[model samples]
Target: MRWEDIKRYQVIEALLLWEGKLNARQLMDYFETSRPTAQKYISEYKQLNPTGFEFVSQQRAHIANDDFTPQFIDLEFSSYHALFNTQGEHAVTSLVETLPQVHRNISPQLVRPILQAIRYQLRLDIGYISLSSPEFEDRIIQPHSLVFDGTRYHVRAFCEKNQDYRDFVLSRFSGEFAFEGEATFDEAHDTLWQTDVTLVVCPDHRLTELQKKVIAHDYQMTEQKLELKTRAALLKYLLQHLRLDIYQAAAEQQQIVIDPECRKLLAPYIN
Candidate 1:
């Protein structure tokens, strides 16, 4: 098989292993592939997912054979150790906290389950508490991805009751899960837009040449000013990173002209 084919097969393997047994319809959506193509891969995957077996005939679905073992799993202990040190500055500290001395604070039990749900695209019914809202609320979410926010873990997912995509603080997901369901793949839910954020960076003339180099890449120098095009969601982050409040007429208006609904959705952050 070609490298691309091997990579595609790997995606299929990970999905099946993560989800346990995804139906043909779901598999088609997940892989963006035809039924025949997915079926061909599924036939091959059965031999691999040990527990995965074909349920052929009229009322057909994939089933786990007796020999099936959950080989597809979250990062193992060794894998966790290897990744811990290199993750970031807080990596060593977080690793240490996860040890027995601080076991309850960074609960390993909670960490593994949340990681598994993210890896497998599992739907989770969690009792979560927010700082703003002291009361714990029951939430049903289809976990889609993970984002590292420089510090703690954050899960990006589609919250069913909220009827929109939202980022949840992992630590706030404190209570026991009420229910966990196999995930149904979503295409539109995953196609996040590529956001473009523009900025005007006029490094003050008083600053030295090194200072100009420091702020150079994030901006473009004109005759006496700089214009920048960056991919970001919020203007605040751009302003903070550029470390300049310089403004220009064209730079202000050149922001992408997206749909009204999209603008409305982003207004709270962008404005």
Candidate 2:
């Protein structure tokens, strides 16, 4: 076997030892390897000791020894599961449908380690591709949590380079990921946490199904008006892409309404 393959083998072994024993679907995310590759690895590992491996088909989980069943931490699966594991299904299928197309790019392999890191607060050495740059940069980032906006998966990590917390879009990254060490941040995205947006929704638009859903889930609505309480940066992104028709005294106007705070922040875009 090649050195990289041997490392992959070792990594799988270590992960199984730590996780007790994971199912084929679980292994695909844990190792970022294909189902066939995971199966081959399992078969090879089982071959070494014929009596060591056991399968519980009903539970859809595996056990290393005949007497032991693996225990799992309760967790929620996101879009990454659908992208990587073909057999797996998401619980929130309706919510998934309303989301933007960017979320479909989430890779299952990218989700698990980051989740594990946040759970344990581990620092990771990753070859990350930044959104603004064409080159891949190697950096050690302290991962906190995964944020799922309607359209994409973001890894919120304390970037050593920026000396601040930043979000990395998972699908754009390509390379080996390594757990370097442990680190902590006083707050993740301090500026973002402090920022808020106020969305003044006109009464006529309040009855739309999409408006009702967005209001219910994302904002607080009061008497035909909604105020979106969210980060300013996020609101700016929404404003830039928003498609809506405006009516001023029966004259139809086509424009997207941005929060006042967002409009000032996005003044450069104003013409």
Model 2: per-residue Cα lDDT over 136-225, one tens digit each: 878788877666664566776788889987778877666458887777662445566446655454333324665545544543445535
- The best candidate by TM-score is 2
For each candidate, give its TM-score against the true structure.
Answer: 0.41, 0.45
Model 1 lDDT tens row, 16-94: 3433444566556545669998788767666665445556455466654544444433423443343333333442214
Candidate 2 colliding pairs, count: 0
Off by over 4 Å in 1: 1-105, 185-188, 191-214, 217-271
